[model samples]
Target: MKAIVKGALAAGVLLIVGAGIVAGLRGSEPSAGPGGAPSSGPPRQRTLTIAAASDLKFALDELLKEFRAKHPGAQVQVTYGSSGNFLAQISNGAPFDLFLSADAAYPRKLAEQGLLSDDVFSYAVGRLVVWVPKGSPLPVEQRGMDALREPAAKRIAIANPQHAPYGRAAEAAMKSKGVYDAVKDKLVLGENIAQTAQFVQSGSADVGIIALSLALAPAMKDQGRYWEVPLDAYPRMEQGGAILKRAEDPELARQFRDFLLGAEGKALLERHGFFLPGE
Candidate 1:
């Protein structure tokens, strides 16, 4: 009987010890490091990928800085390119949470194709401009599109109208001004408006039709002079944005969309020389 009692006591002690260890472990925080300090790994953050039009390159950069400041735990990555190409990629399953197109037509098409989580909405109106490097021999500002016809203006850069909205606008403007046929031979196409600006700035092209927002950016502002293409020269460049149907976080995407449509976003767009829709 004494041996049996001793064995039972040992078994009970083992059970109690095991329960205590489990309880201690369950109640304890993560393991500590040297000096008994709790280890702090990187904080978890939600990430969002925004596919935006090239015209928004500078504006979006500034807006995102403010957005991250407002939501410190949120991470945003932007890919700036031609809106038409972005739409095609998104349709083909590009992993983008948001799409901001330079023209509303692309987003509307996405909506029609069931690629959008919600209805597309206008964000801003884009403006096109003719940019010539400062001190260019051709008087682009005074002569406008006519400046391209100057002998010194041998090369002119414009975004590829095949996929870039700004390029289409540039083409339309030139056509309306009756200069397209004359200047078409001298045209050098950039992949996007940003690249078009670079072509002029880098002296690869004597002139470029680029986004007004880009011309207003500090990098280009000091290096060139621009003449805003009259709004009537081309159709309105209504820019739009939408959340993708396959977004990883629909609510987060919606928040971003709302932010862009909100006052702060509108103010930023205006500061960047973009006109709000209906303005």
Candidate 2:
């Protein structure tokens, strides 16, 4: 009986020491968070960086908002500029996860250079417009590209043809309409289509050749009127995008690319005045 009692006492003391050791260790540990993981703090956010064409500002804004709602963990950063400029930047190793170009040729060029992680895919067909502020008497809606030659239009704004696809389109449309030679001396250049629209809006230029998407944006729509440039006048502005070979997260870039190509994104782009690829 004594031996049995001694054995019980030893076992009980061992149990107590074991329990105390466990309690001490638990006290030393960080408290478990909601899912029983040590509370290291909030989970790290997944970041996606995109270089996009200026024409997509309004439409991409809404699309990104929807994407964020769907992916709360994702943080997307976008830089908008001329497609050619972005292409140069990406080629020089700019840290962009995705590149959305106003012209597919830019992305195709990147693909040829072995810089793209994925195949170039068309997103929308961009169109140009002759835009003038509502108060301006340019008659752009009636005369179309011909209005650029009007006496009242002392200054006409267009993106720089050297780098901007829209600028090239504007030049082509004017040339096609036989107005290029007449108004060539009156042209002002913007860094991109958005800036071109700003020139007309601010009265810095009497009229602007800009993207139809910009002319349809809420702010631009309220302040200006526009006429769609004839499609045949300029080469088709088939916009496209590609994932970068150096993307920090290729899968995340791909997911966003898929979202942009999805039906919801298509509807949003259409609402912003972008024509769908098929229609």
Candidate 3:
């Protein structure tokens, strides 16, 4: 019996030693990095998801490219839509890390609902424009808002004023110019500003009231010509951004917010036709 017991103990010791050796070998192997490069340790990967307004589409795309260059290990995903819709989503506990609104009011509303991690800050002042695609029958530059009254202007697109800030501004501008009542019947509502631009670009609408930022985008710049809507015609389109309370990566969210308020971000916004808050 003693001989049998001794043999069993020796076998157990050998198995334990073998397991430890295998574990050590596995641990010594270098880990894979982002692009499958050998890493001395586990690489850090962080991701942030942002919900933004449609007007930010172009400028934000450029900003993200620069941001990712600076934060090589971080990934950012953006969803663009109407600010009011995003506000409703975040209020209901959407898993967004940040929210960039077309109007400060939406972010302020979120903050009031206690859904934001910090106070909202104005990032830019969005401008509205009257856009007509190339080869359109109406003389947009010559007639301006009056072009919508022409028979050739059968369909005019504007973001849904019920939710989109740009839409509200467009309505306000038309009303101020004494054209809203005249063009009301010709208006076709787009779900958002980007879609409003699409409506005109695709010839679904004869013209559109859209964000100047989108008009300045390379895709749209040559596709159409735009006339800036008089700034005084509507309430200021003060845009804002904030970090969400439920952000999985709060630090990253804050960094990105700061980046938007920084020099590079301001420059991009300006190039895309957005005005700084004070400007």
TM-score against truth, every candidate? 0.84, 0.85, 0.85
lDDT of 2: 0.80
1-279 per-residue lDDT for model 1 (tens digits): 000001112121111100000001112234576899876754344667888888787787778777766666666778777788888898899999999999999989999998888999999999988999888988877999898889998888888888889989999999999998888888888777777777778777898899999989877788778888999999999999888888887877888788888999999999999999999
Residue-by-residue lDDT tens digits, candidate 2, 1-279: 000001112121110100000001112235578889788765545778888888888888778878877776677788878788888888898898899999999999999999988899999999998888888888877888878878998888898888999999998999999998998888888777777776677776799899888888877787878899879999998999999899887887988889999989998999998998977
- Model 2 is weakest, by summed lDDT over 10 consecutive residues, at 14-23
Per-candidate Cα lDDT values, in order, are 0.80, 0.80, 0.81
Clashes of 3: 0
For candidate 2, list the clashing residue pairs, or say none. none
Global lDDT of model 1:
0.80
Mind giving the per-residue lDDT tens digits that candidate 3 earns over 224-274? 887888899999999998898899889989999999999999999999999
Error of 2 at 184 (Å): 0.2
Ranking by lDDT: 3, 2, 1
